[model samples]
Target: MFLPIGQVKKTGLSCHLKWFEQHEILPLYKAGQFPNALCARFIPERPDVLAVAAYDGSKIIGMAGASADTPIMWQIGIDVEKNYRGRGVGTYLVTLLKNEIINRGKLPFYGTSLSNLHSWNIAINSGFIPAWLEVETVEQENYYPCN
Candidate 1:
C-alpha cells in the first residue's frame, strides 16, 4: 500500500532542472561521480527509467530519477554531489522529478535505510511519507521456524 503525501513546493535555489538525456547525462554517469544506484539505473536501455537533473552552470550538482517497477508504480532514487549537498539540491531534484512522474500518470515512491536520516528528511521534504516496509529472506532454505 502507498500513502498519499502533500504537494511539492518550489525551491529557491539557483539551478536548472532538465530532463535526463542519454547523450548529455551519460558522461556524468561514466565519470563515476554519481551514487551506485543512480549510475546503475540511469541507462538508455530502459525506457521506463527517467531522470531529472539539477545543473549548476554546466555541471551536474544533483539528480533525482525513477524507474518503473510496475505498470503503475515507479521507484525513485536520488544523489547529490558532495560539495552541493545540504543546500536543498536533493529536495529540489526530488520535488521536480516527483511532479514530472505524477504529470505523466504514474505513482512515485521512495525508499531508504532507516539509519539514513538525511535521505528520510529529503523524502519527507519532497512530499513523501512513511507508508510501507519491505522485508525479505535471502536464504529461505536455511530458515527455520521458531515457536
Candidate 2:
C-alpha cells in the first residue's frame, strides 16, 4: 500500500464531510461536531492539517488526516472504504500521516473507540502508543450544518 500526501488545497468543508459520511463512519454531522468548521478551523492555514488520500491509480480507497493544535500535541484520524479494509491501506495512511506530523515537530497520536479493534490495531501499527483516553457525550438538536 502506498501512502501519498494529498494536495493541501482549500477543499470545501462540505466535500470532506460528505466523504466521511459516505463511508458511514461519521453517523452524525453536527455543526460543531466532528469535522465541523470549528474543528477544521482549529487547524491553521498551514500544512499542519495533513490530509492524505489513498489511491488505487486514480480512485481513492482511503483517507487519513492529522493536525497539531499545539507545539507538541497532535491528533490523527483515518478511514478506509469497507471493501478496502485489511489491505493495509489504513495502516499505510496512518504511518504516512504520522511521519508528516513528526516532521512538523509534533507528536503523532490517535484516539479510537475501545470497541474498535481495527482502529486500535492501525494506531499501533502506525507507531502510536495508547497514552491516555477519555469519553464524553453532548446533547444537541441541531446536528448538521444549517447552510
Candidate 3:
C-alpha cells in the first residue's frame, strides 16, 4: 500500500478533523477506533506522529494515522466504524491523511494484506496503488488466502 508521496490528492470533502499526537490519543487507541493507525503503545521508530479523526456529533466514526516507520516514509493505517461502511469515510480520511503527510515533508503510504478487500478498496479509492509486497521465508505460507 504505497501512495507515492507526490501523487496524493485531497478528497475535498467536508470532513471535520480533530488532530491528535502521541500520548494524547490514548483514549481512542484504547477504544480500538484505529488500531492499525495507532500502535498499541508508543515507540520511537513507529510512533503515531499524527492522526485525523472523523466524528458524528461527539462519537468518533473513523481514524487515519500517519506512523513514522522510517525517516523517508510514513505508513498510513485507517479504520472506519462498522456502521459507516460503504459511505466513503475510509477513503476521505485516508486521502486527507496522505496529503497531510506530504505537506509535512514526509512520504505517506498505506499497508494491508492482500486478503483484505475492504482495506484494499479504500487504498485504491484514496489513489494509492499496490506499491510493493514484502515477504519473508516462512513454512507453508498461504498467499492469497482469501481465495
Candidate 4:
C-alpha cells in the first residue's frame, strides 16, 4: 500500500531530490556508479525503469529507483554513498521515489534480507511495512519426484 506523502521525513543534510530523465539516467549508467542491483534489473533503455536521485550540490549522493515487475507492481531499490549514509539519505530517497511511483498509478515495494537491519529500518522509516516473505530453493538433480 502507498503511504501518504506528508508522513515522509525530510533529509537532515542539505540536498535536492531530482527525478532523472532518460537522458540523465544514461550518463549515470555509463559512469558505472549506479547501484549494481538496479542496473542489473532496470536497464536504462527500458521505459518501465524510473529513477529519483539525491544531489548534494553537483554530486549525486543517493538514488532510489524502481522498475516495473508486472503491469502494476514495481520493485524499488536504493543506494547511498558511504560518506552520506546514516544521515537519512536512504529514507529520504526511498520515500520520495515511492511516492513518485504511486503518483504514476503503480505500486512500489522493497525487499531486503532479515539480517540487514539497516535496510529494514530504511524501509520502515520510508513508510513501508512488512508485506510478504520470499524464499528460493534449488532442486537436486538426483531428487525423485513424488506423485
Specify the highest-TM-score model's number: 3
- Residue pairs clashing in model 4 are none
TM-score of each model, in listed order: 0.77, 0.60, 0.83, 0.77
Task: Tell me how far the alpha carbon of residue 61 in candidate 1 is from the true structure, in angstroms, after superposition.
Answer: 0.8
- Across 8-91, the per-residue lDDT of candidate 2 in tens digits comes to 222122212122222233222232233411143433542234556666666556677655555576667776777888877777
lDDT of 3: 0.80
Compared with the true structure, what per-residue lDDT tens digits does model 4 show for residues 45-87? 4333778888888898888877666768777778889999899
For model 2, the stretches where C-alpha displacement exceeds 4 angstroms are: 1-48, 137-147
Give lDDT: candidate 3, residue 41: 74
- The alpha-carbon lDDT assigned to residue 26 of candidate 2 equals 26
lDDT (Cα, tens digit) per residue for candidate 3, span 89-119: 8889988888777888888888998688998
Q: Looking at candidate 4, what is the lDDT of residue 28?
A: 63
Please provide, for model 1 over 46-147, each residue's C-alpha lDDT reduced to its tens digit, 9 standing for 90 to 100.
Answer: 433677888888888888867667768877888898999899998888888788778878888887877789988888888889998866557677566894
Comparison by TM-score, 3 against 4, better one:
3
Q: How many clashes would you count in candidate 2?
A: 1
Scored by CA lDDT, what does every candidate get? 0.74, 0.56, 0.80, 0.72
Q: Which whole-number lDDT from 0 to 100 does residue 147 have in model 4?
A: 42
lDDT of 2 at 17: 19
Candidates in order: C-alpha RMSD to true structure: 3.9, 12.6, 4.4, 4.5
